[model samples]
Target: MTELNFPALGRQPTGCPPARGVLVCWLAADGSQVHVGDRLAEVRVADDRFGRRIGWVSALATGTLWHQVRAGEVLTAGAVVGLID
Candidate 1:
């Protein structure tokens, strides 16, 4: 099985702190088949400098998707949002 991790999108070269985000929604339903580069979920990231922004989480592997986190769940970088099997 492969894990789908929330990316560290808010990291900056200026040494800005890592930001947390909420799992806005999943683009594909649970158990749906996915391929690499497919947009899997939308996230609402709250960065201190950038304020709020939308970010996309993509599938890292091609397989059946299983969501481990629900919508509105707080997420950090490297958090496992789902599994591919």
Candidate 2:
């Protein structure tokens, strides 16, 4: 299995994630099929100096999307968002 981490949306050049974010939506639903590097979900963020206000959760391995965090869920740094198998 491969673990999907939440995007470093609020990570700045200073090496800090200043703001928390929410999981806005999933591009691919749980139990759905995905390939390597597929978009699994979108995260609505609160800053841009670090990255896009909307960050993406990407699949790292080809497998079935499973145990994805729900939309509107608050995420912090290093949060494991999804798993593929």
Candidate 3:
């Protein structure tokens, strides 16, 4: 079985409308293969005042994108945006 992990340990965002923005700019474009430690998505969050917040998520293991994500989207903590097979 493949194991998934956080690319970097940081404050995980919670709640609704003011979700953290997710961008897949630093990794392969959607539909490309990747490996563990490879940049998956770069997240820029907003502080209570909606300022700049930062974090990144990388491939936890080598796999294909069972699904794809886009840039400038919002995500909640522990949301599985992609599936690796």
Residue 38 CA error for candidate 3 (Å)?
0.4
Residues 1-85 of candidate 2 have per-residue lDDT tens digits of 9989877664456766456788888889788999997878888777755454877888899988896578889987568888999
* Alpha carbon lDDT of each predicted model: 0.88, 0.79, 0.57
Using TM-score as the measure, which candidate wins? 1
Question: How many angstroms is residue 11 displaced in model 3 relative to the true structure, after the best TM-score fit?
Answer: 3.9
Report the number of backbone clashes for model 1. Answer: 0
In the range 1-85, model 1's lDDT, one tens digit per residue, is: 9998887775655665556789999999999999999999998887777888898889889999999999999988789999999
Off by over 4 Å in 3: 1-19, 24-26
- Order the candidates by TM-score, highest first: 1, 2, 3
> Against the hidden reference, what TM-scores do the models get?
0.88, 0.80, 0.61
- Model 2 CA deviation exceeding 4 Å by range: 13-18, 48-52
User: Model 2, residue 9: what's the lDDT?
Assistant: 60
- Candidate 2 lowest-lDDT run of ten: 9-18
| Candidate 3 lDDT by residue in tens digits, 1-85 | 3433223224445543334455545455556788887766676655565466677776777877544455665565556666567
